[model samples]
Structure formats: structure tokens, C-alpha cells
Target: MASIEKLPMLAAGYEKLTAELRALRDERPLIVDAIEEARAHGDLSENAEYHSAKERQGQVEAAIADLEDRVSRAQIIDPTTLSGDKIIFGATVTLLDDDDKPVRYQIVGPYEADAKAGKISYNSPLGRALIGKRVGDEMEVSVPAGERFYAVEKIEFI
Candidate 1:
């Protein structure tokens, strides 16, 4: 089997995923009870409860597998430990758009990406453009709507 590539993420993101996986594992007993109850209902051919329970079990199994894979390939990086004056992964970059409006975004891993929360994935267009850039440096990023220019105003590890 091909080796799985490691995923880069901040310590917070890694901890969040770990907690979610733990919670899911804890729900295993409840899922078992659901399956047993469904089976006791009898008539498997027409049993909607049984089918639903089986589907839920499949979903749980899939989630567990996905979480396990991510955990196995995790390359956790603590932002607080990093000291950088330039834009890099896990750095919170403040930018000034063409309109001179300030916007802040944290460059994060794919799984931790939340545009609404100002966290962009490293593979995203804007994140790629910001990489290696320093404060006061202007860069053009290609978005789905087209190219947009941004000036780096500040870079922080937090």
C-alpha cells in the first residue's frame, strides 16, 4: 500500500480532531444498543429500523476509519512555538486588499480550513499566494472570480 502523506496542522486543530475521535469511540456502546434493539424488532426483510441501524453503523465505521487515517498521518505543529516574521503555514496573516481594507487569515491544513473563521487551507489559492510573503509585500492571488491583489500588512504566529 502507498504511504499516506502527513497532514500539517496547528496543535489546536490536532487536539480538536483527537477529542472528536474519542467522543465517537465513546458512542460505540450506544450504537451497539441501537443495532440490538433494531434486530429484536424482527422481520429483517421489512424492518426499516434494522436497515437504518445498519446504515448508522456503516457511517460510524467510516467515520472511525477516516479519523484513524488522519490521526495516523498527522504532523502537528504548534504555532506558539514558531517564531517568524514572514508568512508561512500556521501563521496568521493580515492583508490589505485593493480597496485598502484589512483582513486577517490563518494559514491552516485542509481539515482545519474554515473560511468563515478566517482560516484558509495551505493548498488554497490565497494561502499559496501568501506563502513566503513578508509584511508590506504585495501579491496577486487567483481566485474563482479572477485575480485579486493583496498587500501583506502583518504576520503573526498566533
Candidate 2:
């Protein structure tokens, strides 16, 4: 038997996925109604409404299945419950860039990653380098902008 891979995520991320799943499930009935109404318009061969509705149903079902899988494999983690000297998942880290500017980011799951919001996925290049690092530790990462260097300045659970 193949082992199931667990997806690590914060509680908030888990809740968000579940909420989205609920919304999609709720929309199922509406999609069904739309398909029925479209079918009543006759001639399925060239019916634009029917085709559109069917396409939407397919998209929604695919999304629902993907979300369901992610939710089912989710392993919710609370940052506040963690305490460590080295960086790890859920660790809010502050790094000093080559220019000495402090940049802060929280290592989170892929679904919760939002670079603009200072949340990075643990699997990200920078995030991966920062893992298991402590204060004053320097690391380099290659990004789309080019190679960059950073030094761990601080790590916090919250």
C-alpha cells in the first residue's frame, strides 16, 4: 500500500480550505439547476447555455475534488505551540538582506503562502534555506530576480 503524504498547514489555512469546500458544495445544487434550465432550451448540439453550464460544472467538480484531497491530507499546526531556536515550519523569521534591510516572513504551507503578506511557503527557495537555521546564520537563494543572500536575525513562534 502506498503511504499517504500529509500536508502541513496552519489551523487558519485548514479552516479556509474547509470553508471553500463548503461553498463549492453549496454551489452544486445551483449548478444542477442551471444545467436543467439550460437543457430545457432544447437542441443540446448547439445550445450555448447548456455547453457553458456543463463546462462550469466540470470546473467546479474538479476544484471540489482538489480541495477535498488537500483538506483530507491536511495536518494542522499551531505556531504558538512551537518553541525552538532553529527555524522550522510556522516560524516567523526575520532576515537581514545583503543591504542590511530587515525582511520578515512566516513559513507557512503552500496554500497559505502570500509573499506580499510576508507569508512564504515552506517549500519556497528562501524558506527551504532558512529551515534549521539559527540567528546570525547566513544563506543564499536563487530567485527570479537573481541570487540573493540573507542572514537570520531573529526567529519567533508567533
Candidate 3:
């Protein structure tokens, strides 16, 4: 029995990966054509085209394997299905740091992590600290810089 760990992902994230996999699969014919053309050029020992084509084939196969592994382990969790007041996966949270400055972030899976977009992975230090917290809850997180305190201002599922 091959057991796969459940990978969490947002619908958009899942769709994006699916599209990438589809594009890779669609490029298979072009890769085959390139290999055939390269082989016709003769002298196998010094053929750059042939070597490049083989390298491309290896890259494509590796990508396919990685994508398959991700898809197999995926456990899609819809944000809309959640009904909770406490912070949990897919929940957008607003926190006030010790300085009284507000920072907003959404807890998502590793696959959907995009710090620039305000999406943090649940496994991250900050995200882990925010989990199970409710509005008005004060918590301290130990980061590389030092220990920082934050108060949960709001929790929303979006």
C-alpha cells in the first residue's frame, strides 16, 4: 500500500498546478519531435542538439514526477466550508503587534505560501502561533530575531 500524506491547497493553487502539468504533458509531442530531428543530424558523439533534447526529456520527466506526487497528496480544504471564530487553516487573521501596529495575514498551506501576497503557510512560525487563537487573544512567538508579542484583533474566513 502506497500511503500519501495529505497536502493542503486552495482551489486556485490547485488549478494553477494542474494547468502547469497539462502544459508539460502537451509539450511531450514537441520534445519527441525535437529528439527525432536531432537524431537525424548524425554523429551522436558531438551532437549538441541531441544532448540538449535528452537533457530536456530528463527535465520534463522529473517535473512530471514531482507534479504527480503533489497531486496525489493533495487534500483540498475549502475556506467557505469552515465556520469558526478561532484561527485555523484558510482563515484570514488580523493581529496587533506589541507596538500597536496592525498586520493582516492568511494562513494557507505550504504549496500556497506567498508572503508578498499576505498568505503564510500554516507550518510557518508566525502561522503556527496564530492557530487556535481567537479575537482579543494575546500570544507571544519566538522568532529568529527574538520573542515578539501579538494580540489577535480579528479573524475572518475569506
Candidate 4:
């Protein structure tokens, strides 16, 4: 049998996907009804509404399938339940720069990584630099803007 690939993500991220999947499932009947109604209007070849509804149905089905695949293969890991001294997957790390400014980031899977929200993916440059780092360990990271330096100040599971 082929290996069952696992994708790690936080509990909240998994919950979000579940909610999206549920919404997509709920929308299926509405799309079906639309298609039926559109078909009743006239010849399908000339009907724009029918074509649009059919296209929408296809899109919705595709989204549902993708979300289901991701969720089924997910290996959910709740950061709050994890504890470690060194930065690792699901660890929220706090770092201080040369200017004494603090920046916080949580290492997560690529699917759940939102840089704006300070959740960095393990595959990212900064995340790779921070991995396995303990408190007081300093490292320089090369970002798009320039090279930045930071010292690990704290690591928390939450």
C-alpha cells in the first residue's frame, strides 16, 4: 500500500477546515436546485444561467473534494498541549532584535502559515532559522528586505 501522507497543522486550523467543508456540503443542494431550475428555463446550449450554474456546481464539488482530502490526511497537533525548551513544530517563539524589539512567531505547517498573523511555516527561511533554537541563541536570517538578526528570548507551546 502507498504511504499515508500526513500534514501537520494546529487544532484551530483543522477546525477551520472542518467548518469550510461543512459549509461546502451544505451548499451542494442549493447548487443542484439552481441547475434544475436553470434547465427548466430553456435549451441548455443557449442558456447562460444553466451554464453558470453548472460551472458553479463543478467549482463547489472541487472545493469540497480538496478540503476533504486535506482534512483526511491531516495530523492535527495542538500546540497548547506540547511542551519543550527548544523551538520545534507548534512552538510559539519570542525573539529580541538588536534594538530590543520583540517579535513573536508560531511555527506551523505551510497550509496554516499566515505571515501577517505571525504564524510561520516550518519550510520558511525564518522558521528554519528558529528551529531547534533554545533561549539566548542568536541567529541571522536573510529576508527579502535584508539580513536580520534576533536572539531567542522564550519558547512557549501556547
Candidate 5:
């Protein structure tokens, strides 16, 4: 049932989230020990360590729950499994701006999108504009700066 509505998440992102969830689960014993030790130290009314441990426990549990849900809902796709001229999810594209400046970007899922790494989320403005476009296609994307024009130079699903 959790797999019915597939969530588009990068394979790497899914692996990272599952690893984090495992680490959080491993911290259960430590959190329990901290709480028990704190409780043994003093009264319920004035216990800083106890309160801190309880808060940390709540945070860890919440993170575990969220990560589990995300990992369960993720639908992983390998970029190499694709072969198309048109831009789509996991497609790396090269573009030439109106000013002749060259730019490259890989359209990826939201969780794995890192602008600094030249990875853009498919839901992003530029990514949306690039979708369904092939080499030699011209398009304009509206960004915070302004509308920018680009000509698709290449598409790679590597």
C-alpha cells in the first residue's frame, strides 16, 4: 500500500535517509540509558539532564518516523536506464544562453537537488521549462532575476 503512490526520490537520497534512520534507531539504547541515569540522579521537579534526554528522545523518534516514511514512499530510478533526446527526470542537459554562455544541469528529484552541484529539481522553474525539450529547442525560464532564454544543446541520461 505504501508503494501505491510512488514518490520520486533519487536513489542516493533514499540510501542516505535509510542510513540516517538506522543510526537513529541505534541511538535508542543510549537515550534510554541517559533517561534512566538522569531519573536516578534527582527529583522529577528539578532535573535538567532528564528533560534534555527526554527532548532528545522525542527528536530522535520523530526523525526515525519521518525517515521511515520517506524511504517507504521512495521510487528509485537509475539515470542510466534512460535513453532519450527529450529532457526528463534524471536527465543531464546542456544549454547555451542568449548571451552564448554555456550552462549544464541535471534534472533530479527534490531531495537530491543541489543547485551548487548543478542538479535541479524537476519541479523547479528551469527544470520545468527544460522538460520535453530536445536539442536545438529554445525556451525561456522565469527566475528571481528575470526571464532567461536558453537553447538546448545536449541531453544525456547518463
Candidate 6:
């Protein structure tokens, strides 16, 4: 038997997934209606509307299944409840680049990661390197752009 993989996420991330699942569920009825309306137009073989609706239905169902799986495995975590000197998931870390410029990032689950938003997945190269690091620790990570180095300046659970 294989063990189930758990997805760790913040409360907000879990809520976001559930909300999207609800929206997708709500869209199911509309998709069925669209299929019925397209079928009424006849000629299923060459009917563009029917084919398009069917493709959309497939995509939506696939998305719903993926979201459901992720939601089912979700382990909600609160950052504010965590406290430690070492970097860990849900830690908001501040690092100084080679130029001594400070960059802040919050370690989160893969689904909640948004680089532009300063949220990084715990599995990312940089995030992985930062894990278990304490203040003033230096680490290097290889990204698609190039190799980058950073020094841990601070870690907060907020």
C-alpha cells in the first residue's frame, strides 16, 4: 500500500481552493445546459458549438477533480502560531542579496506560490535551501536565470 501525500497550506490557501471548487461545481449545471442547447442544433459530427461545449466540459471536470484531490489532502497551517529560530514552512523570511538588498518571501504550498507576490513554494530551490536556516545564514540556489546567493537576515512567523 502507498501512503497518501499530504499537501500543507495556509488557511487562506485552503479557503481559496474550496471557494474555487464551489465555483466549479456551480458551473456544472451551466455546462450541462450548454451541451443540451448545442445538441438541439443537430449534426453532432460537424457542430462546432457542440464540440466546443464538450471540450469545455472535459476541461472543467478535470480541473474539478484536481482541485478536489488537493483539497482533500490539504493540511491547513497558521503562520502566526509557529515560532522558531530556523526557517520552516509558513515562515516569512527576509534575505539580503549579494548587493545587500533585502527581499522578503513567505514559504507556502505549491498551489499558493506566486513569485511576484513574494510567496514561494516550500519545494522551490531557494525555499528548500532556506529551510532549517537561522538568521545570518548564507545559502546559494540555482535558478533558471542563474546561481543566486542570499543571507538570511530575519525570520518571522507572521
What tens-digit string does per-residue lDDT give for candidate 4 at 40-125? 99889999998998999999999999999999999999888888789999999999976889999999998889999999999899
Find the 10 residues in a row with the least total lDDT in model 4: 77-86
Q: What is the C-alpha lDDT profile of model 2 across 38-129, one tens digit per residue?
A: 99999999999899999999999999999999999999999999998999999999999989999999999999999999999999999899
Which of candidates 3 and 5 reaches a greater TM-score? 3
Cα displacement (angstroms), candidate 1, residue 38, comes to: 1.3
Candidate numbers, best lDDT first, in rank order? 6, 2, 4, 1, 3, 5
List pairs with backbone clashes in candidate 4: none
Q: List the global CA lDDT of all models.
A: 0.90, 0.96, 0.90, 0.93, 0.89, 0.96
* Residue 150 in candidate 5, Cα distance off native in Å: 2.2
Backbone clash count, each prediction separately: 0, 0, 0, 0, 0, 0
RMSD of each: 1.6, 0.6, 1.8, 1.6, 2.1, 0.7
**What tens-digit string does per-residue lDDT give for candidate 5 at 92-126?**
99999979898999998887899899999998999
Best-to-worst TM-score order: 2, 6, 1, 4, 3, 5
lDDT of 4 at 67: 96
Candidate 2: RMSD to truth: 0.6
Task: Say what the RMSD of model 6 is.
Answer: 0.7
Residue 148 in candidate 4, Cα distance off native in Å: 2.3
Preferred candidate (lDDT higher): 1 or 2: 2
Stretches off by above 4 angstroms in model 2 are none
lDDT of 1 at 131: 91
Q: Which 10 residues in a row give candidate 2 its minimum summed lDDT?
A: 122-131
- For model 3, residues 40-139, the per-residue Cα lDDT tens digits are 9999889999999989999998998899889877888888888788999989898999899999998998878998899999998999999899998999
